[model samples]
Target chain A: NAGVTQTPKFRILKIGQSMTLQCTQDMNHNYMYWYRQDPGMGLKLIYYSVGAGITDKGEVPNGYNVSRSTTEDFPLRLELAAPSQTSVYFCASRGTGPNTGELFFGEGSRLTVL
Target chain B: AQSVAQPEDQVNVAEGNPLTVKCTYSVSGNPYLFWYVQYPNRGLQFLLKYITGDNLVKGSYGFEAEFNKSQTSFHLKKPSALVSDSALYFCAVRGGGSQGNLIFGKGTKLSVKP
Candidate 1:
């Protein structure tokens, strides 16, 4: 299984531009999440979806949006990019069972904003 | 607020010696703690988790962690470090029983010198 996959491994954007970082998981997981990794800042949650058609804002949700149309896809949208948005983005998923707390992560997408 | 902290920015250890990466967390109730590793320019990989049961949790790549409830810490350890063990390690905790709301610490870079 492809566990989790993220598109556009690397991207560059100018301030105010917009784009979507696509993420898909084949694990049939009920929970999916988006996280941004900045140097010395660790990983901050941006958004997450419990299931299809259910999404919620995370700790660092400002400037980002997300939609979960199907169980397999959870895409992150940057409406108006800024320099602060330049970071490595990762998508992750995990099962709903009480014992399944560990997350399976994607390869990550590197974004650079000017 | 739920949070995770890796006290050391970097840990240096000699090959064949033991190593420990310290992590502490703050959250209400029993926390679901996890450890993940990331190589340079790569995504995070699951290492271990502590949800319930035994306080000592073993995970991938021959790594183990002890969950100290009183201390609210999960320290990753290895009996014998290897050069290949050099990477960025992260500690995380589930936030408020939400839908996969995981909070991560500023990663600790592990360096094993030969």
Candidate 2:
């Protein structure tokens, strides 16, 4: 299986630009998450979904939106990108087990905002 | 709230030497802790996790972590370090709620020199 897959391995966006980071998982996991990794900072959760048609805001949800249209897909949207949003975006998935199961992450998409 | 802490910003070690990356966590109920590693320009990979039993959890890449409930710590350790082990390590705690959200630490960079 492909596990967790993310698109746009690299991208450059100008201030006020908009884009979407697509994430798809073949693991059929019930939980999906979007995280941004800054240099020394580990990662901050941007958004998450428990299952299809369900979504929730994470620690750093500003300027970002997410929708879980299907169990396999959860895309993150940047309405008005800024320089602060320039970081590596990682998508992860986990099975529906309480207090169990580790997250599986994608290769990550590096975004540079100028 | 569930939270994780990697006390060290970075850990340095020479090849064949023992290495340790410190991690501690806090949560209301039982804490489900996890360790992840991120290579250069790559996503975070699951190293190991502690759910219930087994204070010592072995994971990929000959890495292991010791879970100490008394100290609320889950530190990653390796008997012998390798240059290839250089990477960023993260500690996370699963939110005790049913949603199973994750809270991550700022991360610790492990550098192994030959």
For candidate 1, the docking band is: high
- How does each model score on lDDT? 0.93, 0.91
Among all windows of ten consecutive residues in candidate 1 chain B, which has the lowest summed lDDT?
A: B94-103
User: How many residue pairs collide in each prediction?
Assistant: 0, 0
Native-to-model Cα distance after best TM-score fit, residue A44 in candidate 2, in Å: 0.9
Please write out the lDDT profile of model 1 over residues B61-83, one tens digit for every residue.
Answer: 99999999889889999999999
Models 1 onward score TM values of: 0.97, 0.96
On TM-score, the candidate that comes out on top is 1
Residues A16-109 of candidate 2 have per-residue lDDT tens digits of: 9999999999999999999998877778889889899999988899999999989999999998899999999999999965555789999999
Clashing pairs for model 1 are none
Candidate 1 residues lying further than 4 Å off, grouped into runs, are none
